[model samples]
Target: MPIRAVVFDFGGVLFDWNPDHLYRQLIPDAEERRRFLSEVCSPAWNLQQDAGRPIAEANAVLVAEHPQHAALIRAFYERWPETLAGLLPEGVALMERLEAAGMPLYGLTNWSAETFPYAWEHYPLLHRFRHIVVSGREKLIKPDPAIYRLLFQRMAQDLPALQPAELVFIDDSQKNADAASALGWHGIHHLDAQTTAARLHALGVDC
Candidate 1:
């Protein structure tokens, strides 16, 4: 079957999402940074938090376990935004090409309700997509079969209409991409948008 839809992960793929930058701006002390990384900076913890766990509850447990970075963690959690700071030019061009080609497009992002709207506002290009699925609003996170299943269900396409192995999905996390591939969706390990777009083009995506 020919490719029908193109999906993208927001963070690291569409734009730069570096937690270290946050720490560099907010917490300048090397000792404090080390302590925080050890106590509170496991990237995988985001997966746990996104998997329907209450953010407040997660914070409480972390603070109880490690009081030193509790204040920083709380502030970081509160300050987090849904949309990125700026759009990547390459990403914009690629999406434009995809849209111009009449290829169906969708976005599957592990995003927060608070910040998702910001991206929608600052990046009007989102209006070009067929659908946008945000984990925070859906109350379902990724790398889970259920979330992926929800995407398939909401799409409401006949199985015969899509090549499960050919439908392209781009995500920065290898674990998430691998999991998506395991469930029969083709996953592209993404870096920057231009490289990703080129790779997808090679995979037969229009742009």
Candidate 2:
């Protein structure tokens, strides 16, 4: 079946997001910054917030565990917007092309609900999506079939109900892509906008 809808992942796929961007300014020293990111405000620790734990509560837990890095931990949420450098122009162009082709667009991202508003406000392009399923708001993360199912359910309400095979899921994470593929959805492990555009064209998307 032809893909009827295109689903996009927000962080690595649409925009660049790295804690290092904010930590480099805060820690200064390369090694210390690396250590702080690895040991203090780690990805695993940050995933808690993405998993729907309130940023304040998550920060408090980290602060209690690493009192010396309390300020740094707090800064993770306080200055979260700094972590999002900017949108990928190539990706933006691809989205524009897809939109022009009349392809329905959707977003699924594992971003902290508390910090997502900053991105939502900063990026007007995000408003173009028909709907966005935020992991934090839903308490579900990618690579989990449940989240993908939720997206399908939500999209089905207003749009024609689509089978998994009729949906094209795009994400920078191979794991997430593979998960969607397992459920019969067409998955694109987006590496670059140019290559992804070609892939979409080959899949008959014409974008």
Candidate 3:
């Protein structure tokens, strides 16, 4: 089906998304790694933090709630690092082309509330998307059907003609992309932005 809408996952699909890169470079000690990873990255604990809480609030709440890991929690926040690479030229070009072609564009990302804005400070071009959906802002993360549904609803609002097969979503994570597809939306697992953009352009999707 011809794609009337093109949605993208912001992190790895457009820019490099590597938490390990921060850990491996910043924290060389194995013991510190174990401590930080356990308390900070634990899904249950991180969920509260990811859902729009200020980092300080998250830190205090997490530390108080998980007393056993209090010491590690402090280090985790202090050590957390983020990076921003320039948008890939091909990806940027493709997005512009798609915009010019009048295809509705959207973004679905799993970034934490704090992180997304910080990332935005660096990658201002993110403002280009027609509708942007971030899990942190919605208090729901991807791989969960609700987040994808929200994107679908928003896209429908902008491109009233939108239908399942007419939308194309790209994400680096199979789990997330699969979730989008499970909702009957068309999705492509991204390998690399340049190649993926080229392929989409070839398909005449305008991206």
Best by TM-score: 2
- Tell me the lDDT of candidate 3: 0.73
The digit string of per-residue lDDT tens for model 1 on 17-63 reads: 55565676677997877666555855656555645456787778878
lDDT of 2 by residue, 1-207 (tens): 787899999877789899988988999999999999988898898888898999878888888999988888898888888998999888888999999999999999999888888889989999999999999999999889999999999888757766888888889999999999998988899999988888888888978
Candidate 1: pairs in clash: 82-115
lDDT of 3 by residue, 6-116 (tens): 888876667765555456565689787656666565656665666556678877877787787676566555655443444566666667777888877788887777767
Off by over 4 Å in 3: 30-48, 51-54, 61-72, 75-97, 198-204
lDDT of each: 0.72, 0.89, 0.73
Question: In model 2, where do residues sit more than 4 Å from their true spots?
Answer: none
Best by lDDT: 2
User: Which scores better on TM-score, 2 or 3?
Assistant: 2
| TM-score between candidate 1 and the true structure | 0.82
The root-mean-square deviation over C-alpha atoms between each candidate and the true structure, in angstroms, is: 2.9, 1.1, 3.5
